[model samples]
Target: MKTPEPNACLDRLYRETGLTLRQFAQDVNRLGTERGTPLKYREPSVYQWLQGHMPREAVRPLILEALARRLHRPVTSSEAGFPSSPDQLKQPASTVQGLIHLGREDMDPSRRAVLGTGLFSVALTIPGWPDVVGRMKAIKTDPQRRIGQSEVQAVSAMTDRLSDLDGEFGGRYARPMAAAFLVNTVAPYLKASASSETRKSMMSAASFLCYLTGWMAVDEGAHGRAQEYYVKGLELAGASGDRRAYCHILRGMSVQAANLGHGTPAVRLANAAAEVSPESSPRMRAFLAGQQAHSYALAGEPTNAWNSLREAERAVNQAEGQLGTFGGFSSATLAYCTAEVRHALGDAKGSVKSLKEHFPLRDSTDTQRSKLLFSSLLAERQLEIGHLEAACATWNTVLDDYPALHSGRVDEKVAKIRTLLSPYRANSIARQTAERSRELLVK
Candidate 1:
């Protein structure tokens, strides 16, 4: 490694982080990639930066975010001897920038380790959600070029195509393609000139893509990055005045929080979705109410949970008059959430009934990965209720589907099953099932 003089500021900052130079460099590269600019810095590179050499311009913001996270405080560019303005750089400055950043970073394989490692944060992620606000800013389009309805259609078309890919193949294969679409294609249109109507369509489509990217992030086991994308998607949807997209984004974020066990924030985000979309169709309300019930169950508030679930059923019924008005709600989604909430509330029988309701509907759909997920959910619930053989059957279902998927989300679920089976090593079926799961998981 090339040597540089021992420097004052860099040494002090490095010491404050308490990470060795190699570790610091790894973090810097990971954070840099997370900010849309992948870096290949090493210990020697850090020494050079500390010895008064300037780092690349894009890397400065990443250094700030990484340092702030490491030291648990805001980091200024000036403190790092970078030329950029010395303001908050930990968070992305704009929704567009953040979305673009997430797209670029998610495309890198090296940074995926960070994604796997820091998928949950109870304290930092949940409480940081902003209060109710609408349409905070307007998107400025580039006047140098003209964009038309064709461009907007293309974005939505690509989003639809990618959505199908995610359903069949899993997000591991689709996330980078989606990110590439956003970074290399959709991003330009977001900044290009378009008619007022076309602009809203573009923004809404972009928001939808960003939200899908967030979902993909979750599938790839990057829940922290997923949260950021959801926030940006919400803002973009809000900016476009797309109530449907905004509500959907909020619901997605709520699911992430609840999955991470941040129950209160999950509840707040779900309510925000409902509150912000007053004109929501009955179908939409059904979906949102179900989401709220999920969070309430996670929060251990059975009254609120059941109340929301009942409201969801009523909304679903009300929407029944309008054919195809289920919007985002389906018989499958309602039952899935019901099973989830019941399991969380420790209603084993209720969970089994709801899971039964869900399986038939979900099986009719083409997504095998979703089957792996809900099957594991049912397996865990069955095990909890002392149905060891039933749990083993569910485990077999998951293992059977496991080979077809390359999804981190499914991997995480099966991993939990492995842990769940550990205590039952004495049972021959449980031991054999766990052993088979381990072998398949390793492959």
Candidate 2:
């Protein structure tokens, strides 16, 4: 029998990670679980992979992601001694090409299950302002076509309409439509000849749309897919020199990290967003700082968390007379941030109080989906703080709208209602709440 040569490239990368064979195996297994596919690799599996045996194709990305997380940067298949998969071989060469590819994949129902396999890496390389400004690759322009401010306005308007739909309903249905628009309408516009000013405007408009699409993905719990869209948005925002848009997208990425309970990355991303744009308005400052407060709390930095929260409060107070900001950051939003901060810091009672304060401050323009999600959170906290009847009352309100919504996150919360109330089944209200949740789950 012939002896296979050891994988020198994989060996080198593995050494750089400073992980023992068993540690490396455990990392990959942990990441696989995060991606919803639990893995059980052991030291023997790592030894085989290092000894010139190819890892399973499905396990390659998890290995790369583990390495990336350890090294604090992206790790490619080639760099890790893995042969390029068919998808990697055909990777899009430019930002626009990549966006089109992503949109097409998202629009295809058959590809979605595959798309959901993407792993959200804590060390994913986020492009900085200097790294991406004017960085769009040379696109093959369509000689017969041209775009102007009107095209830019159309894209922006469509994004706003899509946002409204996502807010009222859920991303489950709105996302496919957004994907179609990106592939059909926006991709062509990106390739059409246009004046420099018009081109930047279009890119900026498209960037915001990308952010919205990623936000919708987050709503559906397709987190890894959401990170891909957010990175594309950041690239486009930087290419167009739209600092506001870039900062906004970075903040959105931070929100995603925080939502997934990855505190370190969340804090890093939030700080980057706040620091990168030095010319932000007070409202924008508040928007950024509120997220910073949440991220800091999650990371267990009590002093930093409290400081960031105070900064957000002051900034929002200063922003009172300003016209609506990018995310409509207001007193209500500040209150919600306060609730998140308190909760993360283990002050359950305070968290519930801040959450209660958030409701009355909300205006008519707020999204129904948010109202329900936050209400669910409030109920959970109310239960935690021994307000069983109050929790039941809040949950009943969520049930009224739960049947109509199709959010994965909302579904997760609704399902938990049963588990949380199970021990309290002797109480009439708790039993009724559990029954209501069971009925919904059965459907």
Candidate 3:
């Protein structure tokens, strides 16, 4: 069966308040800013909501908050046409509705938060083995237009393009594009005619795009929404029999957890992905192992971390294939993970060594974020090794990359650098750069 559309109640509330659609959007953005997300909503987004669209679960509460403040009364979920249970992507046959709702909210600048608000909790990432591995052989679908290989290929190509954009500039740049494509282009196709094989292929493709959306949500710092995307993507992936995508999505969640400093969840997700991973792709295996290593390091299990790193190295050496999507544990990714592991184990100099020796330096495209990250870490590591001048010099790259990116992840690196340099503020170079970072951040 096709997915259902979200119902609407926002129009009535707006009419009662006598605010223009534009004014209503402005109010939402204003309220969001005061609460720290600094949303960028405008008239069209609000118009869509008025026309029966549901905002994302995260945005709905804030939206109601905005409306209540404006109307001088309490605005509840029912009045806004939102579901009482806002644990998104969990309800049955709710995938399409959830996607549409999330799409509208993501596209609206007024609902934009700094991203990654919900900490990556184990509750969100770890699932029972039965739930994840439960696979359906064939979907019973018979849409009207007759879904074909061509449609599946189109979605795949679009997903690849979005992934490329993600690598180049990060999720902030790729998110709206993914959301719009899924909503306008893919949604109709999903709801329309197709045979079992076509449906399976299309479902897998849809699942992949959803995974991409979740990754971008994490990159842009919307952890709760990211988890929602992962859950729905996993459901679709299972039905499509796309074990690879399923494993990859789980690994993606692990990456989020690792970055959020929730080591146990990160390790749990990685281990789950490893258990379900197909043996055909050595590169994928390597990726999962590397992920495990990073998580173990985060968890302060140095022995496990070392063992996992060895396993990762072995798998990377054996890997021989055309690289898969999700970056395929590329050389650069391996180096990054290796550095991360070392850093987690408190080996500042070793992290620096691995970073410089193994870090991908050729064909510099779509890796500015990682490159800048390594440089920034190098600065910190240099400080750890008592090379203050070298540390200061290494920071130049980070400062250079700062203005070119719009990632919340990168903004976080900036914040850390500020704290790291505080004790040395008496030094001329340190004070100067600190001042410079302060000014740039203010802008």
Which candidate has the top score in lDDT? 2
Best by TM-score: 2
RMSD, one per candidate, in order? 8.0, 3.0, 11.8
Model 2: lDDT equals 0.88
Candidates' C-alpha lDDT? 0.76, 0.88, 0.75
For residues 183-242, write the lDDT of model 3, one tens digit per residue.
Answer: 887877776677678877887899899999988888777777888788878977876777
For model 3 the local lDDT of residue 99 reads: 70
Reference-based TM-score of each model: 0.75, 0.89, 0.75
lDDT (Cα, 0-100) at 75 in candidate 3:
70
Predicted structure 2, TM vs. truth: 0.89
Per-residue lDDT of candidate 2, residues 1-443 (tens digit): 78878989899999998999999999999988878899999999999989989999999989988887778677899988899998877755688888888888889757777766467878888888999899764768898999999999999989989988888889886888999999999988988999989888998999999999999888888888888889899988988999888998999999999988877889999999988874767788888889999999998998999998998899888886633324748888999999999999999999999999999999867789999999999999999999999999999999998888877789889999999998898999999998998998789
The C-alpha stretches of model 2 lying farther than 4 A from their native spots are 1-30, 40-54, 67-92, 321-326
Off by over 4 Å in 1: 1-92, 114-140, 321-327, 363-366
Superposed Cα deviation of residue 102, candidate 3 (Å): 2.0
lDDT over C-alpha atoms for residue 169 of model 1: 73
